[model samples]
Target: MTDPAAHLLIVDDDERIRGLLQKFLIRNGFIVSAARDAAHARRLLEGLEFDLIVLDVMMPGEDGISLTKALREKLTTPIMLLTARGEASDRITGLEAGADDYLPKPFEPRELLLRINAILRRVPSVSETQSAPKMLHLGPIRYDLERGEMWHGQTPIRLTATESALMRIFSACPNEPVSRTQLVEDLGRDKGVGSSTSQERAVDVQITRLRRKIEADPKQPRYLQTVRGAGYMLAPD
Candidate 1:
């Protein structure tokens, strides 16, 4: 059974598919919203937030992969792509494009439910222990793990949703070098959503934005330093 509180966005050009998916997922206990295409999805996205998105690869105008790439620019919401193509190369393309996961068309509804649950399971749960004053000092910035808050001296630093998610992921395994692939998967973007170059670029952009808020010198980051080819590691003082 799906979580009734889990909100899902279904995007497909085919009305039949969209309606069927919405009804089926709703019956399984999810709150679902359907969009006819990428354009419609964008409109809905501007006004509402979803726990996950079910996107169709083949659409009239903007394809699922393209929209996935665009969304990865700002949002870290989990996205699963529905595609008719079953080729391995196509699957790779979808993952590289920034999709968290992909499902081929003509799939069993049960399988879809299972995939959704699996992804949701991977999302870390908030703990009461996180409310303690366990803090990490990063130069002039300080992060309070329990409160999920960051501060610079006496002032609180604001973080975007994506930035906060990244911080939580990093704090869960401090001093460890987290690979880009791991970060992408944890962020809930389709693992098959982007090229290596695209994933690297997106990670870079997020890192730069995060540094501006947490680092005294964003250009020469001391706390969030890169680890050669291994990936990024957060070295808190």
Candidate 2:
């Protein structure tokens, strides 16, 4: 079963599909939000942080492919595209546009449930291994490795789901440079997302956001250092 608090956004033009999915997912222990089209999905995204987005590829105003492409520029949230078209090229196009997975329409709800759980499982979580440090310090901010929580002195700081995942990935191997390709793969993005260059670009956007929380000055990140030819390294003190 997935986390009961995990929120999902469902975008589809079909009212029946939207309602049915919302009801089904909620019954299975998810908090579901339904949007009728791409425009509605955009509005919800602007004001909300969803664990995942279930998007339909055939929306009227802005198709799922287009919306996925635009959202990828800023968000690292996992996206699963749903469409009636089952062609290989369509699936490739959706993945290239930054969708994490594509589920062709006419699929069983149980199958969808399993896919969603699989994708969520791939999201990096806290490292509780005996070898891992219990805490990580980044100047003024402190991270509890076991709890997956961050703090600045006595006050707690909020991190988005993706941000928390990045910390889990980095903290596991501090002072070591992790290539963007590896980070993308670890984040559950398939090779179908595109070339290494494009994949790295997506990871870059996410790193920028993470630096804002960990560094005193994001423009000159001290804790999150960029290696010359390598990738990013977390040099926590």
Candidate 3:
């Protein structure tokens, strides 16, 4: 079973298909959102983070192929294209456009579930493993990934519940950019209406506070660096 926590975005011009997919996925233990076309999908993308995007290849405006290519330029989210034409060439085009997987139309809903689960399995989680490094030193501050504790020498630096949650998310994917929207979702604040700007801003504030606890120079961060167009990344020593 895929993590019931995974969120998916469905893009299709057809209203009926969108609604049916949304309901089916939700019933099968996933959070689902839908967009009418490429333009609508872009608007949602700005404010939200999705685990996977299930796109329909044939659309009226801004076909799925074009949007899939554009999305690859900015985000690393996985995409699965649904095309009515099951030809080898059409499938090849979708894959080359940067979609992680593709499915032909008239396919069973059960098959869609299987594909989504498979893709999500490839996403790495942050939970510390016995094998992965546990102690991370960032200058004077030290963190225990296993215990989610921060220390300054022998003294412990306390973290709020929200701060602790952020640490876990960042530690799980150390040296990787974790989008602001994904941070909000991982923190359990994404309520599914859309990605909340208020929540995004909240994450920024939390990052600032976290810097104060760890960075030797919070003014010029060395560990928690912001990726220009992406988001924040935690680079531990």
**Which numbered prediction scores highest in lDDT against the true structure?**
2
- Model 3 bad stretches (over 4 Å): 125-237
The sequence of per-residue lDDT tens digits that candidate 1 reaches over residues 39-138 is 9999999999998999999998889999988997777687888989956566667666666667887888887888787666545345833543378888
Tens digit per residue, CA lDDT, model 3, 90-186: 6657656766566887888887887777666544344544556888888888888777678999998865445666777787788999999887667
TM-score list, all predictions: 0.62, 0.63, 0.55
Better of 2 and 3 by lDDT: 2
- True-vs-predicted CA distance for residue 152, candidate 1, Å: 10
TM-score winner between 1 and 3, please give it: 1
Reference-based lDDT, each prediction? 0.78, 0.81, 0.78
* Residue ranges of candidate 2 with Cα displaced over 4 Å: 1-13, 16-115, 122-129
- The true-versus-predicted C-alpha distance at residue 114 of model 1, in Å, is 1.9
lDDT of 2 by residue, 1-237 (tens): 767788999999999999999999999999999999988998999999998999999989999999988987788688899999967667667766767677877999997887788667755555443479988999989998878788999988765455666788898899999988788877654433345665566577668868877889999999999998898999999
Displacement of residue 140 (Cα, Å) in model 3 is: 28
lDDT comparing candidate 1 with the true structure:
0.78
The per-candidate count of clashes, in order, stands at: 20, 0, 1
The weakest ten consecutive residues by lDDT in model 2 span 188-197
